[model samples]
Target: MSRSRGSFGQIIFADQSRIYNTSTIVGRIRVCGDHFTKNCYTKTILGIKKRKGGNVSSSFVRSTTKSGRRKGIRSSHADAAPCGQDAPEKDVGCKSRIVETSMPYADHDYSQRPPSLEEQLQEAQKTIACQEELLKLRKNRFFLERFQCDDRLIMFYTGFKDYITLMAVFMALQPTAESMLGWGQSLADQHIIRKGFEEQSPPLIDQFFLFLCHLRQGFLVQDLATRFNVSQATVSRICITWTNFLYCMLGSILVWPSREKVNELLPLSFKNTFPRTRVILDCTELHVKRATSKVLNSETYPYYKGTITFKSLVGISPYGELTFVSDLYMGSISDKEITQTSGILSLLEEGDEVMADKDFFIGDLLSPINVRLVTPAFSKSNRKLTPEEKLQTQEIARLRIHVERAIRRIKEYHIFDRTLPMTTLGSINQVWTVCALLTTFQGPLF
Candidate 1:
């Protein structure tokens, strides 16, 4: 037996002893196994039959079957054999061999066709909608309800004593806020500017909460927007609207105590040392961002603070209520000038005494209004103060410290701790005034 490759690339085993000598041209032979046929021979092409007048190529091989007859190899049909009953079957002495090969896309083949662009887009839209719903579910929807039970959180976030007081103030302001045409809206237009997007604006109470958060927390507009789930523009509008609204609403209330009211609330310490004191005045400076213009820079630069600042005079009743907050002036302005221009003198009457720090040289200004100035005595000509003057200075110092405490309360808002941006210049005065007034709600300073 010998093994060789046939022209069709199939392995062929032939018995050399059965070879027959014949003048015949044999072409490639293909053998397939078949069990149903007796002869087991299907269509066959014996290459080319040799004839007397026909030419046979020498490259062709000659072979014969066991009967010593020529056998053809090439078939006229070039198509592959089908695997069913209709295909011609051939029988050989061997069983059929099963060949296994790896398929490249076998595991990756999909049962259905890939989705089209429209289908994918629709799926993405559905996912986004679901995500939005989940976000809304996770976030607390009501600002007031969320903090109503937590007074510390209310204080931390809005500087209110508790939810009750917060709501009380809101209730007082709500009527005017609801009745107004809108934020800075004209009476003729009759259009009210809503706090947020029309479809998703927070309730009026929540809008008030948002504004309080902005003021007390000193949160940026973007931060308030994110916390409230509104646009930055909406937060800005809310802040401006509420600032003006509060400036008008709260400012309408008279904070300056009258002479009898001051005497009624005056503390014993003031009564013993300075029995006639009406109010204690002090000058405080707030840091402000540098301005673009040279004139602004020069005018706002406070020599004491070494930075651009806004100067305001804060006056408290002897008992520590912040009775007066002067409009912000340039840092470069003198305390005497601020006192002269702050209009506090007009509010004072004869026999009313004003107590202040030694830096205030406004005794001349007060004298014209017939208001007495009580301040710590300064040594003159390097002379030591007398024992009585020393006791008087100590008493004045002890009594004047309350005004500093009042200023500290105002500064506790934290918004004034940092240098204010120039953009807030428009409403910063109102902000300062509102903060000063809100401290009255913190209970008595004494």
Candidate 2:
């Protein structure tokens, strides 16, 4: 009467050993007879039913042949009784025990009986996920949804499209890039271009979209050609043509409003800070490759960049719109020279004030023309700026940031942000002009 209770037993039930799961079970409880009395208890197979709340109970069955042969565990009513019930051919004093617990994701070597309910549910879920992925669709990045989300994103990749007079109405409001892209698609509908000998390639929408990408991304002509599946010559041509096209389309659109117009439409930000401001002026530079000619290299090279660079002056209206952009100048040239010769001051009216950085010594120059220069106070080595001067500097800086942002928007074209090749230097002005005007597409800066 020695029972090894609560101990697991390795029952060599029927021939198959792998049909049961090793991990999916909660726990296994086994009952064994005395170790010394090997045949004292009947060796029989049983079925265990697991409940949702982690309760489990076992039922014994005569799952073996009467001839003393091995057979699989069975739960059929003909062979066994449910838990707490008796088996018809129970061993004289046999008791069954659980051997092991199961692990999650345990694979069951399915034998004769069907799989459990839990396993079936898992398979169905996986199938549904796959079917959903197969059925889903996505939009083209340039033509629809992506554009509407951020118009600035489209301007960065594909600048304003070829102008149609009616397009002015669409440009007046800041719509989602998607709506504009949709409108652009409808506008370019049925339009096409070709060269007689070449194989047909991607359409102009993609071509120009790619062109804008190349401009803002600064990808090389050879790389762009490969990406668009066009020849290097085509890439070069599109770059030059589109640069000229955009400049022609957008460059002349920026108008220098009269002083009265400026006062009438002055935004609250400028009105509160610098009411008399005609424009916020700032200078920017672009790095370029050293030129072939020594004079060209000498002229373009500047100490600030440690490399050849091009410099230009940018001015934005009080409402954060670009009103002026000087022609590209060699970096070595002084800002005053660019300002003097660039003809920007000629646009200013008497009594108009130009807000600028502290560096611009254009006050004496503007004074003669009856135009005033508003700049941050200079901190001389002999004496620091007074408290009042410091406060004026902060206010000026606050207003000046809008101009810096305007310049930043110009550089956003990315082409301006990269090292310029000598070949493209000829059209750098067009590139600059296009980027400046492209700001309109970015919605109102204010």
Candidate 3:
């Protein structure tokens, strides 16, 4: 008899050759006759082999055969043995082979269940809702709302409407290069004089004016382009043309008010609140793009922002009308230099009183002009001003507040609030001048 143990079950055989050919046996088999025998095969039996390729010992083989025969005899009486003794052990050994053949491979196609129409609709709704929420948040935080008012209120605000109407008219009046060239051509044909003097195209004056209006209304170039159906380049060109035009042509408009005009337009209360107040003069810095070279940049460099800028000297009458505005100057230039160079000092007459902040050294500039400069008098010799001088300084400051208000209004146009594009300084100056002109048209501040 032979015996073997495997993953599935134990096997017993009267002859090794019979057992080796048979794969499985379940339950029990009993032989009654002397010639009866049992054969079984298991995985362990197949795995058993002598090392070094030598045949197993005859004695060992005989002992294994005896053991197998005893197990077979016991198996025949499995009912009298332990419970579950009839279950075949061979099935256990076959498990690994079965799994390897039956399991899905990595590249196998999987059965997919299609999404329902209802599920797709729900997903789309969720996406739309998320988008709407995001849009709402952005609108609330970043976008400026359009104005809302009844027709009556709109009619009453004729000043605002007039300003808008003028801006629209200006926008509509922009001439194309073709038209400008034609005008030049006509001139050349009719006049027939100079040899090298070819027809030159006029700048886009109308577009530039419209650009100023857009800035005054607080719209960026991109936004203006979208609204006006023009490219950003067109918008930029218009802005540049108009800014330079206004700064150069309208510079003289911003001047100190004459005594007669001051008396006529200024409020009666101003006479009591501030005495001998001719005009309020101040300097404001506008940021600009840094020049390419350090040396050129230093010429325009502002000490405060460490960038190039234009310093504007603004003079406002007691009535809140802009009396004078200086042509844009380099940021490095001092207020006193701008006053002298810009010929604002020439605008002053004898006995005229000027009010400004501490930055303007009135003693040196105004004293020479026979005009008195009023500000908070700084303590000299480490001593405070006398009570009378302090009272006068307080009055001057209160009066000067109106000029500050005027400046605040000018700065409301965002183009001047921060560092503007280096290429657009001329345009910005033009825009500022136009806005100032428009502001004057809005009515006196008083």
Candidate topping lDDT = 1
Output the better candidate (1/2) by lDDT: 1
Model 3 C-alpha lDDT per residue in residues 2-110, reported as the tens digit of each score: 3334322433333312232222232332121112112221235569521322222221211235546533222222222222224555222211111112223455345
Please list the C-alpha lDDT of all candidates, in the order they appear: 0.75, 0.64, 0.58
Order the candidates by TM-score, highest first.
Answer: 1, 2, 3
| Alpha-carbon TM-score of each model against the true structure | 0.67, 0.58, 0.53
Q: Which stretches in model 1 have alpha-carbon errors above 4 Å?
A: 1-142, 184-196
> What's the ranking of the predictions by lDDT, best on top?
1, 2, 3
Q: Give per-residue CA lDDT, model 1, range 1-446, as digits (tens).
A: 22234332543433322221122222333233211233323343766422332333332345679998888443211132222335335222222233322334555446678899999999999999999997777557547677789999998878888999988998998888877544545776554544334547577899888887777878888888888888887787778888888888898999888889988877788777788898889999999989899999999998878999999999988887888999999999999999889998888989989888888898889887788999888898999999999999999888888889998988888778778999889999999988888888887677
Q: How many backbone clashes does candidate 2 have?
A: 10
Considering TM-score, which of the candidate structures 2 and 3 is the better prediction for this target?
2
**lDDT of each residue in 368-444, candidate 2, tens digit only:** 88988999998778798889999999988988898888888777777776677888777888878776776665554
